[model samples]
Target: MGKTLSGKVVVVTGGSRGLGREMVLAFAAAGADVVIASRKIEACAALAAEVRDQTGQRALAAQCNVGDWAQCGALVEAAYEEFGRVDVLVNNAGMSLLYPSLDQVSEAMFDKVIATNLKGTFRLSALIGARMAAAGGGSIINISSVEAVQPEPMAVPYAAAKAAVESLTVGLARTYGPAVRVNTIRCGPFDTDIAKSWPPQVREFMAGHTVLGRIGDPGDIVGAALFLASEASAFCTGSTLAIDGGFQ
Candidate 1:
């Protein structure tokens, strides 16, 4: 992966941990200068340091609350200031809360889930999409979830937001056209903080859904991100690469 993204600049939201963190390392390994953003300033800074140490590539840590429009703007601006250009944007910050069924869902929980997962992705996509368009071209990778398609009983709101993400991926691809590529990866169960937070029973159930009979690692997504970011996927847009281990 040497220099596949050499001299490129990338921004990965929620990059302080989990899949977002892995994507930060992946991009840096491919020779891209990366901006890692999350609400946790210390976490971001620590990840930035680790990335720079491991990959020897420039990495910046920015505190960003993706639910806030002004904060998202600042996140984009921070990326530009750090590297002067953004060649790729990965909208990966999101949240979820599981319950028995839709009846168990609360209005406040629904709103918060939608705000972070849907509104955040939408806001960041608009900001980065414009910059990519103005710069003549770039890639936008949205991280969706298998729940978007599988639609488990416990994750109604999460599934809805993720489904919306898939739609946004396609819509943006259509509108941006040959200028900027927009794509998505409908990620399956992964061994991350999100999964660990799930109740033990749900975790066991998810593990059985995959043919692999195991949860996924955060690094499982690196290849898809690399392909979309590199020229290898130049012709790919409006596509949803399901990294689900045949869960569906």
Candidate 2:
């Protein structure tokens, strides 16, 4: 996949750590100049430096809280200002809070979950997808979660937001189609930073639940992400690709 994205500019939100960070590095390695955005500018800048030094790809570091519409707009502006064009956008920023119980999920927590996981994806895709369509063509990938389909009581708010994201993917694909392709990546239990917080029994259950008999590694997502970002997935859109280790 090296050089598959040469001369292309890619933007990834939540690009500082975990799966987002992995994609940033992989895309840079594939010869795409990348914009690394996250709430923490320091972390984004650090990753940008690594991309530049290690892969010789130009990288832009921008601080953005995708949950806020204004910040999402600013992120779009900054990316275009730096790269002039965005060939690929990965809506990877998401959050799910720990609540004591369903009845105890506060209003703030619910709103925050929706804002970060759903609203942000919508705003980013709408803004950047329009630009991409006008420019001829590009790709938009929304990172969703398996909880959207298999909801757990503990994270109902997050699951609901993700479900909305899946629906948003279809609407966006239609809105920007014939030029800009939009799709979703419905992820399962992956051994990301968040997984570190999972209790031992929860981890064990997750592993046993997947047909692969294990949670996914960060690198496991690279192939699918690269495929969708490149021409390999030219015919795919408005679809959800499960990288869930055959979770059943």
Candidate 3:
């Protein structure tokens, strides 16, 4: 593993399990002190212990509800207090709400998806970008989905929200230039709990959707994240790195 992130401090939201968990370990391996956040404090704490045990880096776990601005503000403050500063911020907390069609989706469900995925990302990025500007500069990575571009018709709400995330990535990069870099990673179907929640047949069909002919694993996302978090992507900003296996 490369130590591209040596001495860096990173904040990863939803860093309890799945992609979020993988990012925490990956960043730790890259020699960064990491702050892990999730709604479940216990899970985040457990992951933090694992990071410390395995990587011997400073690790912190904080309970956070990303959709709440106050919680997001406190999360940033706590991370800075623990690590002195944050050089990287990964907006990795998101959820999907699927329905047959937009017409069939209730207003509440639509609002929930929008709030958690789109609004949460905006709130966190705004706070972090301000801090990064004040502190010179930093990088922000937003986790999006290929579904945003390809459009899962039945999962309109999810697609719409993820699309908004992509838009926010570019918008923030433009608005906070010279101080903060912002980008997004668009991932394809993966063998994660989020995908497992689908119907068995649907899940099986998704496995074949990728040209790679298999669902991606959590590790598949780590390398790209590490590159974005490090100086490797010093010139890259306001772009979407698609980790979809030729699905686009």
Candidate 4:
């Protein structure tokens, strides 16, 4: 069978590593031109080169801090300048630091989490989804976490922000429908770069909660992503597709 996502233009925030990088590689391999967006231009550029070399598909590296509203606009402008239109948008840039307690969660930390994980998704989806709606149709995929619903031992603020992301997906789907599709990938514990720092117990705890008896890997998400990004999910919108390995 032919690879999916042919002739598509996909923009992946946080594309420098982990799940984002995996998606970029997977999409390019499936014949899609990809835009790699991250706060670090060097990383994005490096990945862009790799994508081009590996898949021979056009790739653009654009520096963007999804936490900043203005930066989100710039990213969109840059994507359009290169690809003309974004057929798929993956809101994957996010951060959450563990603190001793919720009381210790500083205002700055809370705001940063909300801005990066929630506000940025809102702004990008609103702008991109509107344009996609106008230009016919496209897909907006938000990267959330299982913590959004099930409270994690740490990163409460982050979990809250992610919950809002899922809400944003449904809202955008309603607003931009008949053309644009907004969906959320409620991810579970994955062995991404950030997870490398997690203590052994925490890691084991997460893995044990899953029916699969393990967390996910970067490559595991590509299939669901490609489905949502391509025409295969034509009937889906305002959907929350969980890639949690059946978290308990």
Most TM-score-accurate candidate: 2
Better by TM-score, candidate 4 or 2: 2
Residue-wise C-alpha lDDT for candidate 3, range 1-248, written one tens digit per residue: 97888999999998898999999999999999999999999999999899999999999999998988799889988988887899999999988776766788898898888888888799989988988989999999999998898887777788989999999999999988878999999988877778767787876677778788777898999989998998889999999999988774
Worst 10 residues of 3 by lDDT: 96-105
| The candidate that achieves the highest lDDT relative to the unseen native structure | 2
TM-score of each: 0.95, 0.99, 0.96, 0.98
TM-score of 3: 0.96
1-248: candidate 4 lDDT, tens digit per residue: 25688888999999999999999999999899999999999999999999988889999999999999999999999999998999999999999987999899899988998999999999999889989999999999999998899977687899989999998899999999989988899999999998899899989998999999998988999889989999999999999999999998
**Candidate 1 at 160: error in angstroms?**
0.3
Rank candidates, TM-score, best first: 2, 4, 3, 1
lDDT of 3 at 200: 79
lDDT of 2 by residue, 1-248 (tens): 56899999999999999899999999999999999999999999999999999999999999999999999999999999998999999999999999899999889999999999999999999999999999999999999999999999888999999999999999999999999999999999999999999999999999998999999998888888899999999999999999999988
Stretches of model 2 off by over 4 angstroms after superposition: none
Question: Alpha-carbon error at 173 in model 4, in Å?
Answer: 0.3
Off by over 4 Å in 3: none
C-alpha positional error of residue 50 in candidate 1 after TM-score superposition, expressed in Å: 0.9
Clashes of each: 0, 0, 0, 0
Reference-based lDDT, each prediction: 0.90, 0.95, 0.89, 0.92
